[model samples]
Target: MRDFRDAKAMAQTLRDALKAKSISVSHSESLELVAKTLGFHDWNVLSAAIQSSQPAAAKSPPALSFNGGTVIPVAPMRDIVFFPQLISPMFVGREKTRRAVESAAANDGRIVVITQRRAEDDDPDFDALYSVGVVADIMNRVELPNGNQKVRVSCGKRVAVVRPAEADFLAAEVVPLEEVRALDTQAFALTSEIFEAYRSSTNTVPPQSLYRYAGEPGVLADVVVQLLEIGVEKMQQALEIRDVVARLETILGWMRAGAPAKAS
Candidate 1:
């Protein structure tokens, strides 16, 4: 029943035992030794894992409107392009990104996740980021022992970044992009076909689990291709699409072309 969350108490016990043996080790050093005994690199990493495992207070997603006046902390994603209706977990290693995540976690857990044009850019300006990204809610976060933080986010809606503001962390003005729901007979039929294709390709059981999204073309397109062997560019392209039917068609095209499998 014991886990990383017990690390602090374990560290205290360790210190007490050491003191009984006339061993003088600082509390911090005892924590480090305990962390290592737990197979963690250091106390911070173990602490992060412990903190992240704690349950966050239940909170509803922020009520954001596409009014162009909505401002939020912007976190730059290095590799992945997030999409609406998708829940993703990512690591925050960059200092600015960690600050942004902290700011969002402190507030409403609402933040704009924009993908960088190049993953190599450590300090990317506004232009270096894709304008179209997802407005996501930070569901959970934990500080890692390696000076990085782990964040789990639930992507809500598509948004276009109006402009970036200068601040301690990157802040941006954005307007939510309305998905054009144009579901028709053809679109509906295509959705079912794509779901089957995804199931066949990925060999996932209980295909009915994805049936919840069967009625929503835009959401279906976003969720299915994410499981495919598509590149980030293709995924971003899918995010950029506003039309439901067009997005599905593009996703189908990728499937037919036999996109490269994602690296495990």
Candidate 2:
């Protein structure tokens, strides 16, 4: 059976076949026909609604629980969204963010990272940032000669920043967004499609490590997002999504649409 991609390709083929038959059908009309055949209002609508109807992240992650634990330090990432399994090199110059790093390092090296809603907001308050982010372990830090701090961290898991816990350094109460292991048939299929989409993308050069993460749906979704180098908005959407299947679909859909059609 043809999946969404395959079916779309068939739609294009139908358009070509119609022209070959000397039948008159405009390209846009053909697309509308294709959309109807696929049960959508039009191609534009199908593009957005082609995804699985269910919300994946709404299902709780297996084997993990959110323990706000102690309020880990909070670092506001400007124009960047971090995901688990990805290493991030961040430069800190802001006083609040630097202090947040130092405080987190003094403890268990855990910190909540949330993205500012606007990159230009130098002094971002809680209302200026996105609530969803990742909890990461600050693995290494060095004081640069330029009066800035260079930090390397590995993102752990998705988290929802509940609110600020008043403190001198930036600190936030966060709830861990638990994730489930991908062992189901649907997940396996989604993983396979994401791999294909990544391979097909013209703008992306997937890392060699892609194969290592492909079997695990969650990691695969993250890997594709990291490798594709898409916009921050798209990356944020992918990161906030919890359903391994839905996450994979979003990444795959973006990649598929990003590339131009191959020559026959």
Candidate 3:
């Protein structure tokens, strides 16, 4: 077993590093991994330490930029942590959403798809929303019988939402996030354990499907994280973690704690 004190210290150091860059760590699983890795046996101690060492406020949201005179807001049906390599066809049923899709296809063929923060609320005027979302390009489209539409979109890049715009349809100004180079050590032992557990639980192997989408070893963790039916807050934490090894360990801890069962 790992020493609880050491683990807490390591987690605190990493937490400080993340805070310096305006990134917020929301997932409990990630915090647990940080504790375990540093040799802590109890996660509660680490959590208390983190709460005590909380950093200053996060920086202000950035401004949005437009392309081809069109900007749109979108809500994702599922949490997409890392964009799948293959193009995914989506069905847009809402009036505002369909209009946003159509406008994107008509203008620059691009739209931002952010995970729906409020799944239960039916109201359309919700103000608090996740700022980070992906900007996807339209690949194809078709009309449905019920006045709805189907669209095929390919993930382009990650973006930060500035603010919601008042328009005939839902629109938002966005700026793209910087891409980070993959690090080798992210393929840690915890990743293998999680993969094995996932296979045993589902009676299905993910290597083949993951390879088809992303070939690199470092990208495997991201692909697996995206496939899991976890919450938006957890997915956002995985995206915010810069260290690949730390992210994989965080996911593995969640798996061990029976996250999938709870999610289902």
Candidate 4:
């Protein structure tokens, strides 16, 4: 039987080969191969070493939140947040979501975007949702070639969903989050530098609508937030900060430090 160390070395060689080719391999796959080569009956021996190292995919689907009242059945969708410096466009498909979009368009075109909590079991009666999200305003609407409706939305502000309300469409009673404290000038300066670097690297240009809707601070903050792949929790935390300068600094710090190493 092959020695365990020999098996490990073989697995490392495979990993190195894959990396050189720009092809990715999961740690689990390598562990399984090593176990089989080493004549091990079980693969769990490498459990501690072979945690999943894959990156998470894009944002979740959109979900609805009620502001004025509560609903018995909650409709869930994956939510994508638009940071102060970013802009996002979304498609509306479901009847409820389409209705929500129409209502927001009629009522100043504002909506809160938040992530949906996965159902605990097969049952869909779960009502729990993430509390943090961004408030966005519809900037433009267009009809796609396939007859789907595409809406361009720009980040308006950060908001926390205080309570869920019942509505025919997505609705939420959200109060704007306080700005981040500006006490960390060092953080702010560092973040700004990172933001500039990201923009240069990505070659992203702000939309004209952003110029119309965003104030000076909003423009800078939105740009940075748009670049980072932040999740519901981080987005919420950023929004909860009441100080504008501090919020920018927090986002900048995240950009510099990079995202969490683990996949979501």
Candidate 5:
């Protein structure tokens, strides 16, 4: 009684057996054949099943929920783009920014963080920030002696600002942005290349942390994107890309073109 987790090994064995018989099939073709033999429609279906069956600890965080309303406190980032499932620390010093973090922490621990178009815009209005951002959970908050707050957040879902809200801090009504995940053999291979490249590039991220999302390519792409030492605009470009394969391809391209894969 094999499950989706064993599908990849089965496909590999099938390919080897066929090769021994002088029959040649592309890796993707073999994956498709194994998926069909397993009663799944396509490799994508089997891949999705594999992702869904991952252990709870390995799975990406569930999609964000806002029963109260879509309007949430918006914190404009200066130079970083936060991605879902990546827990990163943030520094809040501005009056409005501190209030926003406080408000979210005091309530549901949920907040919408959008990157500012220009990092120098100390007081950016909602219109001055990027429309696409992430909804994150405020994990921990510590007040500093310099009147700043150091907060940690775990991003959950991609979100787009629908409109501005009149609040103490920058606030926005946003809608969740769905990821377009089209996983295939190519994507899986790209993930492997990324892992290898990342290993050769930096030691900031633990190998186990990145390898944990092998079954979930989209999440793995985001995890890799978060560790890249690219500029804000390039990071934003990665954030806006919904397709998993496209995202993975773009990241690999950046790495190959020497776009600095080290995390800052």
Candidate 6:
């Protein structure tokens, strides 16, 4: 049994193990991998906890908001919001959410994930969930020994929930959201600044693949959204804006000035 007392050591061990398996991951990727392995949402969450010398319980889960086009099947999240462009590991204990995951996996793996406005609301109705959420494709599912199912979902785009969570699990009528991004010099510059803000705000290591999506306003917006510990309200505000530039500006302003960890 190997015990990890330090984050850097665990990262090196992870990097080495991956290397031994003939897998190559960049430093940032490795850090994020280790962070994920440690049960934190992302590298920033893990790094912050380690630096603060607090228990992992003291560490907050960084929630992201994801929304995209029309979709069926809804997965309600607890505590934190979810963002697109990231693969999330969700432990499903609720029967409805479990059924939703099973149903989505059986049917092309497409579903909408929405955060419950009240964290304690295990069974949320239409009004109990937020209006905006991310639509994603379920990539894989793993059944745990304790009966909880872990599902890996790849977020695609932002969306507005047209329908609500109902019946068994949650099924909603959702519409995919499209950002009106101006593909001009000003837009490009704002996108670049947004990326820089993301790079500056993140701790431990930033993701390497984020560069691939940097030029894409929607993807970049999502990538940045996931990395920050921004509140759910501001994130929802950012999600409602149809303009990519405006969303980026709102998020960037959050980055520069910072906000309370939890949404008010």
**TM-score for each of the candidates:** 0.69, 0.70, 0.61, 0.50, 0.69, 0.64
lDDT of all predictions:
0.76, 0.72, 0.60, 0.54, 0.80, 0.68
The segments of candidate 3 whose C-alpha lies over 4 angstroms from its true place after superposition are 1-86, 123-126, 179-181, 187-194, 200-205, 211-218, 239-243, 261-264
Candidate achieving the largest lDDT: 5
Worst 10 residues of 5 by lDDT: 62-71
Q: What is every candidate's alpha-carbon RMSD to the true fold?
A: 21.8, 12.5, 11.2, 16.0, 12.4, 18.8
**Per-candidate count of clashing residue pairs (backbone under 3 Å):** 2, 1, 5, 28, 0, 15
Per-residue C-alpha lDDT of model 5 across residues 1-264, encoded as one tens digit per residue = 767679888889999999999999988789889988987645655664565456768866646554323459989999888888878899999999998988898888899988999999989996588778888999999889997889999888887665577888888766566676546777787888888777667655546867889878888888888777788998998887767888999998887777666553
| Tens digits of lDDT, candidate 3, 1-264 | 534435545566667787799876754555677756754432543433333233324323323344322356564444344352437777778777777787787877878776656656443542534556667878998898987678888886566554456677767765555433344444545556766867765666755665452435446666677667677789877655545666677777776676662212
Candidate that beats the other on TM-score, 3 or 6, i.e. the better one? 6
The residue pairs found clashing in candidate 1 are 44-145, 45-145
Against the correct fold, how does model 3 do in TM-score? 0.61
Which whole-number lDDT from 0 to 100 does residue 60 have in model 5?
67
Error of 6 at 174 (Å): 1.5
Q: By TM-score, is 4 or 6 better?
A: 6
What tens digits encode model 4's per-residue C-alpha lDDT throughout 57-129?
4322213232333222222345444465347677765677677777777776676665555523222221455
Which scores better on lDDT, 1 or 5?
5
